[model samples]
Target: MLTKRIIPCLDIKDGRTVKGVNFVDLRDAGDPVALASAYAEQGADELVFLDISATQEQRKTFASLVKEIARHINIPFTVGGGISSVEDVAPLLEAGADKVSINSSAVRNPQLINELSKAFGAQCIVLAIDARKIDNAWIVHTHGGKNSTDKKLFTWAKEGQDRGAGEILFTSMDHDGTKNGFAIDPLSKLHALLTIPVIASGGAGSMGHFADVFALAKADAALAASVFHFGEIQIPELKTFLKNHNIPVRL
Candidate 1:
């Protein structure tokens, strides 16, 4: 069986790690580079650095931060936020990011996915979808979950795969920072629909949530921010918990 990955997400705003409920009411968690190094040292499978305000602020962010974090950690990391074109990806990768995640930009121009995949190989292009349940449907939200689109979650995910996205990082806006659990139903549905890896994000409150996401939803990876950022769960301990539950994970 393929070992599931545990990713620590650092939501950056003003160069600091921040976490919030439903994508609002942000509060500082810690310094981004320091947090990245800590998680890497703690046996985190990978790190995701998202400049949370990049899209809304309308600026390129994280290149310098990515480079700094890269120097401190000897593990793969992904940088994202306000990345729109193929030009935007090269600098981050050159800055030492193993991958680049695109959300709002990809939603605005679906061709960006194809262009990026063709330019840098599909393995490095991650399509990040932030969605929320509304009116009995999961609608894709953009601009860091401040705006909603007509696109449905499942359909958009399928389209993203066909468009050459390497992996799907699905964040449930409804469950974000709630400390309840992951959105298992949609995660399971995503796994059923796609061949590529599906990363379940949001609402990771405890170690049990990690096991549930992998054993129940069968997510290829579980990505969480507040839990890891606030020291509520340690990556090494979470892996041990998963292993006890008979879930395969790198220890």
Candidate 2:
């Protein structure tokens, strides 16, 4: 059995970590470099750093900050936001990102996925889909969840895999920061349809939520921000809780 992964996400705005509800009313969480070191010390399986406003603001990801954070942690680090081409990915990787996540750019130019996979190997490419349930169908959103796209969630996931993406990081805009739990139905469906790993993002409130996402949704990993950033949940304690509940986690 593959051990489930618990990842903590750092949503960056103005070079500082921030958190928000349903992608609105952002509040400061902490310094990104400090938080990254703490999460790594807590045994987090991975760390995701997203320059949440980069795409909307039309700026590149903060590679210098990424490098500063990467130096403090030993775990795999993934960076996203405002990444549009292979050129955008190079600096982040050179700054120590183990994976590059592309969202709006992928929807705009699907070929970029194939190009990135071929250039850096699929293992380093992660397709991030931010979707919200509209009329009972999940619709992809971009530009930091400020814009919506006509593309449906599952169809896009399939296209991403065919284009050689190594993993899918699906964030339910509706469930983001809700603490209601993951969108299990969609997660399970995506997991069943894709051979690559599916990371369930948003709506994580407790350890039970983490276990449910792993056992019920069969998500390869669960990523959360506010809960981890605010100290509402600690990775070490959450891992212990999952282990007790029969969820295989690296403790």
Which lDDT tens digits does candidate 2 get at residues 42-157? 89999898886645342433677888877888899899888899998988898888999999999999999999999999999999999999999999998878999889999999
**Least well predicted 10-residue stretch by lDDT in candidate 2:** 20-29
Q: What is the C-alpha lDDT of each candidate?
A: 0.85, 0.87
lDDT of 1 by residue, 31-143 (tens): 67666666777899998887766453323445667778888889898888888998889988888899999998988999999999999999999999999999999999998
lDDT value for candidate 2?
Answer: 0.87
Which candidate leads in lDDT? Answer: 2
RMSD of 1: 3.9
- TM-score between model 2 and native: 0.91
Clashing pairs in 1: none
Judge candidate 2 at residue 105 and give its lDDT: 97
Runs in model 1 deviating more than 4 A are 19-29, 53-61
